[model samples]
Target: MSDYDSGDELLADINAESIVAGTKRDRSESAREVQLSKRPKVEDADFGSTGSNSNDEFVEHIAKTTLKENFGFDQFRHEQFSAIKSILRGENALVVFPTGAGKSLCYQIPAVAFEKIDAAKNGRPHLGSGITIVVSPLIALMKDQVDALLRRGIAAACIDSSKTYEQQQLTTAAIREGRLRLLYCAPERLNNEGFVESMKHVPGGIRLVAVDEAHCISEWGHSFRPDYLKVARFIQEIKAERVICLTATATPRVADDVARAFEIDKSNVFRTSPYRPNLRLLAESVSTKQDKFPKLFKFLREHPGSTLVYVTLQKQAEQLADDLKDEGFHVAAFHAGLKTELKAQIQDDFMASRIPIVVATIAFGMGIDKADIRNILHFDLSGTIEEYSQQIGRAGRDGKPGHCMFYICPEDFYLRENFARGDLPSRQSLRRLLEDLFHRDAVHTPEGDVIKLNQTTLGRTYDIRASPLAILLATLELRFGLIRAITPEYSSYQFEAMYNYYRVVKDDKSQEGKAIFSNAKKAQKWHHIDVNAAARSTGLLRADVIRKLNDYNDRGIILLKASGVENRYKILKELPSTPQEMDAITDKLYAEMETREEDALRRTQEVADLITGDACFALALAQHFGMGLPDGKTKCGHCTHCLTGARVVLPPRPAPSVDMVGIQKILDVCHVRDDPRFLARIAFGIKSPRVFELKLHTKKVLASLEDHDFSSLLREFTKACEAANFGAGTS
Candidate 1:
């Protein structure tokens, strides 16, 4: 026989005998002993197993020769290279791998690869004009990613509201000149006319649009933004060469929305499993807010080293921080409303290890990459599972063991439910307001009938506040198919001087004429105030209102007669009667508003439900993008529900303690008392950078105390510190 045939036959015979001997071995004898006793020696011709070693060598060779030569990588973890290669091949990929799975590298490597390919073909010595546009939801996130890219010697920039006009101009100019390879911008910025124009000239015309936190685009996704709907049109207009959407958390529904927004083919999508075996998720429901502190104290005492505590409101965060500090813990608080510079300082302190715990709201944890956090605790239950997953994902990022505990209170559910209803107007109230406007001829009749009345005449005719009247009119014009409301313009002038001018001119006229002129001036001032009010209510720019007024003047519907005041104008239109169908129209409009309000509330609840459901977070996220989940196979084991039974259960615990020393420690770490919640968040280890930058290390200490009664622990710690003359007998 040939050599290969002989070798195969010999190996097969040896393996057969080994299997037979193993099966027939004594019950008490070791399996390893039996296998070794019957096994053939390595030098024997029958002993050959080279496939596994060959695969390893092949992988190693590729890592050293191919990867290192091209992307400067000596090794790759599971699924990293494959995902990167898939993206490079222009496939629509959805990577659901756990946090710290080298997700950024999946797209970053491909981005570099594309840059290389373009440079090679163009005979360029440097990286070419291929641009990757990343649409991030948060301004902070955009800044963070850009900063990271800059640190890596990559050209990146972000355009957001926080940037000054000069900064924006510079960024836009750089983009047009092809100096920027990656441009991070918020979805809202896409709606700005000036920003949109700047993107058109991006050097290579946007080779790829990578959407970070893509779940925000899907209405069905847990964190939906209304403005995200415009991303699709923006992408099409820019004609992005390729699209890659990325998110740390997403359900199937959210995934579909993302795909639709990018106009990507569903078949090209790629998703990794969301199951994180390294994380341990736990939830404890407390009976009351008063009971939470004690439980939290017990947890802190039980676990040592880095921990995060999450709370919803700023005041609660602050109060908790203060209480914990009084109990002798180093904590800080973080929130969005704080000044930018101060927030940065707090974050710096936390990262530098000055603060160990941070009490914070949802504002603190986006795009942060601190890997040493050992625990995450929620003082209050999160509104949705998507948020819960994201919060917990911050833990165990270093591939180390970490604990995530959530404290659930039933009352917190009501608070969350109320928050969900904050966005939309109440349908009943809206309907009533619409009805009043329609009846008063503020809106046009449904049958194309016009209600022609001067502002002064309308104000006199309805005895209602002029601002609310104008708001109703504008709302009807913009939101409903009502009579188009046109702004009338009168030339604005300094009121006192204009009043004198009118008197001088009317000196030759009759008493009746003088009276008419004086009354008109008064009405003009009131109208200006009303207009400002309208601008405030509708969230429209004063410039837009002024432009509308100019258009009205051009139409000759109203005369802008100068008055002696800065924006005061006299109305010239003759009073017109209300239309015949005004009442019917008003009733219809009001009913519509009521329905809209209800619809908004329902939508909010629906969002909450989608987040709390059993579907895979990644799959639900995919479905949001108009892409269906490949199959319902992936489950994120890191989620609270997945870890601690589908339904959350509370453990019986005693009353909570307010630790004065812990509260003081938190305050010391916070440094800024503007946002109290920020301090509370740090004490609980909620992952606020303010806490991290302060070098707070109370998470470990607090976790160790979690199993005990919080109040008792606080009292005991305080007493011990007092006895030991700690902080000059501060207790």
Candidate 2:
């Protein structure tokens, strides 16, 4: 008990024992419980709901019984049984079923069955049970599903930003003790080191990982989320036993991307056609944006059913909802920017049939489970075929007729195309990012060369949006293998004792904890510890100090908060050392960005073509997913093209022109973000976060040339910046 005379001596002894030179310490904790063996083959065991049990019969019996007992269903929907069978057999599966096809049940039933089957085999609960980790996209979806599961007496939980630290700790503790059967989280949680470290020590390891909305993993897919790209890597790191990738819509090419990422076999891929016979596709051409209101009103009055009116922007949703409400229509606006409580209330109102029409952006309908939505109206062009399919699939879940109408106009096309073109970062910004990576930013550490990136600051400085910057960083880690991201850490920690401060120091038995607590500087009611200063003073690793403090917080000895988070990356290989080498690397990256930009434009055009083309509407839409008409029929007789027998032409947009006065007004705002790309974004009306923060979007000068080509505006801005000596030597 008495190894040293003083706390300083104790700390020095501990530091010497923990610190290693020129090598990265493994941060993963050792498993406390033994790993369980794989499930016994069903043929070798007598495990079934009834007395008789064959391999297939036993699995089917358990699945059906679990479904009946847990989810209250007597029969399996199309392809659900097959997908669940693959999962029960411990094989990776890719499910490309349409929306409302019970995809959630495919994984949820299996999750519960794992424990039930184990209990059946041993005549008791397994000693070290594994849990299923579900990667979902939305926090609201997570909460909804978790609540539903809990109501069914299933132990399920979610980890998301909305939860308090105390709640997260409770969930984490439940996961470690095998008290939970299913855990839901977003794909970004895989990058969280604290969560990853906790998963490393889970009782029997993660048994199954279900990736919901799995098409987001594919950049080729319409709804490509960059965070989804890291899912396969996360799965490998966790070494989960089985995985099921589920999506409501995926093209053949997108399916391949998902399969390749998860190592799913060709035979394991299951597809139920996304085509719904009950839903009719309709299209109309509008002369102007103002014309959509009367047409929408007329349709809604005729239908008088729950409807979702899709819009392109959040403000448009608000404006439309206001206009409709002023016209004495019961409606609400739903978008991502709304407060959490308000969104929940809106969701409740919509589900309860209090609001019949919701004018919303793309964020409204991911996890809502209402069944009788009768109409889905697109007030603007859908961003892509995949998006249109997924959105419209939300209708007619109860096997009733659902009408889907698309209103197309020339201005909609221009607006969407302008956004697509503005998404790319300029070539100069890419070069600047490379320079910072290889030069002023790199910091040498024991593990490797570390670069601390302030993502917001860097985004503004280079005129790169966060998603694109995330993609660029991910490219460095995944595509090139030149770097790997480490856990981001705060520069400082602020904590206060739950009770007496001295009592905390006395309770912490570890010397590292003692040093950390003793060194915290008291400022008013709270105590602050500069993590870097404490590391140097105590001769402890930064990770070690952070761990102990988090441990203290977990034990309820202190309330903790941390700030100044730095996104750290460790260089895995030598970066380009020469100017020529740097140029070559940057050029390749910029070219890829351009390729992505072109692909976005192509997708936008595909939507335009879908509305105006002479082909049968339903057949062309089905062909996008690589399918044909039902029963070898040449035409879906209900679609607009088949019924009308004529193409609907959209009105043409005006020629591109920019006012010189408006251009100068935009340039005046460029002093805040002096980069030429930033100037061009203002001129073309692209809302980067910094631009939004500056409230530039509210100005009329912004988007002055929104009808003009983005590349042309970029060239114009570059010339203007050089002529005015604006942002000189900044690049």
RMSD to native for every prediction? 25.2, 7.3
Per-candidate TM-score against the hidden true structure: 0.56, 0.85
Off by over 4 Å in 1: 1-83, 97-99, 123-128, 162-173, 428-731
Q: After superposition, how far is residue 386 of candidate 2 from its true place, in Å?
A: 1.3
Best model number under TM-score: 2
How many steric clashes does model 1 contain?
142
Per-residue lDDT for 324-407 in model 2, tens only? 898889999998888878887998899999999999999899887889999999999888988998889999999999999999
Deviating ranges (above 4 Å) for candidate 2: 1-53, 120-127, 163-169, 440-449, 491-563, 657-680, 689-701, 711-731
lDDT of 1 by residue, 1-731 (tens): 11001011011111112222222233222542343234321122121335645433433343334456544667877566655554554555665554555666656655555555444335322213547877776776667767877886777777653443346446655654456677776664553443454454344455677776677666556665544555666777665656777776666666776776676676655565544556666665567878888888888888777777888888877888888888788988887766778778877777776888888888787766888787888887576666766787787777788888767664554445334322222233344443444444422322233444443434333322333344445444434434443222233422222334444436625332233334334444432323443444556544444333333333443343332212111112322235435545556655543454354455444434444555543444445433443454455555556554465444443445566566665444445433333333334333323334445544443233233332344344445444445545576
In angstroms, the error of model 2 at 106 is: 1.2
